[model samples]
Target: MSEKRIIVTGASSGIGEAVARQAVARGWQVLAVARRAERLEALAAEIGCETFAADLTQEDAVAALAEAAATFRPTGLVQVAGGAKGAAPLGETTIEDWRWMFESNVIATKRVIDALLPLLRRSTAAPQQDGSASYAEIMVVTSIAATVSYQGGSGYNAAKSAEKQLIDVLRLELFGEPIRVMEVAPGMVWTEEFSLVRFGGDQAKADAVYKDVQDPLSADDVARVMTDILALPGHVSVDETIIKPVAQTHPWMVHKGPLVAKG
Candidate 1:
């Protein structure tokens, strides 16, 4: 079998980084994409995968990325480059922050998909032993914020909700085609920078988000779920998966231990 090729966006950190590393370990030819050249370079050095540094929000950069990706002809595209900017209530959320969230989560995802559709289509052209078409997968890493609304999470909720809807529509549009669209919605993942970024680098504030939370999900945990979905038989598609730690049931409902403040 030819080695499988995959492109993972947001490859500089968090779930994106984890997915890229895991993909490479499983013998896939990985193309890691992110805006940070230094981080991508470091990841490439460690994992021996190809890297592309481009801001997905920029049309010119996305175009260049598409040109590069055409040569790879990847069978899978994992979109994981997204996050929340501020935890402000609807009225207090800055328009700038809301726009950033939408651009980062929804618009960026759409752009990358549009740019890579041609390469993704190539996966279907590969010959199969059964004379049936092979499948190409597009897996999006969304958040539980899409499904449940919480106080002070309006911007994030709206952005993720849009992304989730987009994925659903894409799946319906591509139903008969060999392309498979799937989404994984994770809750309370405690990565090194997720909370910090959301809280504008306030270390104490970031740390407080996960304080006393038992075994919160990690980037690797989410990556494992993504790769497992990809490993399924070509004909089998897990349309949507929601994963969270046992302590978390929804966006705001978390069972912190007694020592943790409940407020």
Candidate 2:
């Protein structure tokens, strides 16, 4: 089989970084994209994967990223760059926060898709025994909040929900084509920078989010799911997957302590 090349966005930290590491371990070629050049450099040095530093929210940056990625000829795209900015009540949330969420999650995703479509098409693999060709894939990382509503999560919920809609429509639009469009929604992933960034660098506030929670999902946990999905036969598509830790039943509901048998 020929080499498989994949482009992973938001590869500087958290789940994105973990995905890059795992994908490399599986002997796949990766082009890791993010805004932090220094971090990307370190990841590249450690894992032997190519890295590109570009802010997905910037038009010029994304355009440049697409150009560079074309040279890599990616067979798949894993988008994990978007994040929540603030967690405030609907009325109390700043308009700026909502706008940023939309731009980063929704608009940025659209831009990357539009920019890279041609290259993805060019990278389609050979036909299998079933007579179905292994086309390029597009995998997006959404949030459980997209489908489940919760207090202080309206802004993020709106953004990720819109992103989910975008992916759904994209799949429809790309129907009859060989390309695969997939989405994964994760709940309660306890990453170092995620809650910290959402809470504006308040360590205590971030710490409180996972306080007493037994084994909240980690970056590696989510990354493993993502890589496993990518490893499936090209003819098989896992359209939508929802991943949550055992402690988390919903975005607003999490079991804080160890699990025990019911009396």
Candidate 3:
């Protein structure tokens, strides 16, 4: 039997890295994609998987990712190769900010999936022996901010919501063929890449973003949930998942658990 092929995007850090690492450990052949060559190389070395250095924001990059996928002929894909938006008041928003958010979230995802359509189909057509399931999974990592309104998130919410809608519709379109579409929505995860990228290297601002929320869910938490969803018995599919910290009531509300003030 051929080893299971899994493709993970945004695999350089955060939830993507965690999922890629975990999947590789489960005897799955992982194709990790991200723009940071050094990071991807280090991860590929540790996990003994293939790595591709491509910025998902570029259409060509997505095409390259698809070409790489064709070689592996993967049965699983985790679309975690997108970026989050920074905190900025609506009135103070820049045009570039809006463009970057859409490019990274919506366009990038569309491009990569479009390129890998054939691979996904192959997985659905293949058969597994010994009662093991050989199904294809296309999972997207979205944010709770897309569903709930929050200040300073107009552009970001719109982009994520668009992708979420696309996935929801595609889910229905892909039914009855063994191909599954799912989305994992997370709330207030504190990861080094996420915080640094969203805050644009402003450590102070990023630190404050999570200071009020006690015990915010880490990237590992989300990864565990994702892996569990994949490990379920045959014919059991998790369509949608929402994960958040206990203290976070919603997108805008944070319960500020006890903590010493930072000077």
The model with the greatest lDDT is: 2
Model 2 poorest ten-residue lDDT run: 125-134
- lDDT for each residue of candidate 1 in 1-263, tens digit (9 for 90 to 100): 44578999999999999999999998889999999999999998899999999999888999999999988878889999999998977888899989899999999999999989878887788676666668888999899999999998999999999999999999998878888899999999999888998999999999998888888999999999999888887778899999999888887888787535456
What root-mean-square deviation over C-alphas does model 1 reach?
Answer: 2.8
Tell me each candidate's TM-score: 0.95, 0.97, 0.93
RMSD of 2: 1.6
Q: Write the per-residue lDDT of candidate 2 for residues 1-263, one digit (tens) a residue.
A: 55679999999999999999999999999999999999999999999999999999999999999889978989999999999988888988999989999999999999999998888877774664466566789999999998999999999999999999999999999998888899999999989899998998999999999999999999999999999999987768999999999999989899988887898
User: Candidate 1 has what TM-score?
Assistant: 0.95
Q: For every model in order, what is the number of clashing pairs?
A: 0, 0, 1
| Model 3 Cα lDDT, one tens digit per residue, 8-98 | 8889999999998888877888899988999999998898989888998887777877887788888878899777666788888778878
Which of 2 and 3 is ahead in TM-score? 2
- lDDT value for candidate 3? 0.83
In candidate 1, residue 92 scores what lDDT?
A: 84
Candidate 3 similarity to native, TM-score: 0.93
| lDDT scores in order | 0.90, 0.92, 0.83
RMSD of each: 2.8, 1.6, 3.4
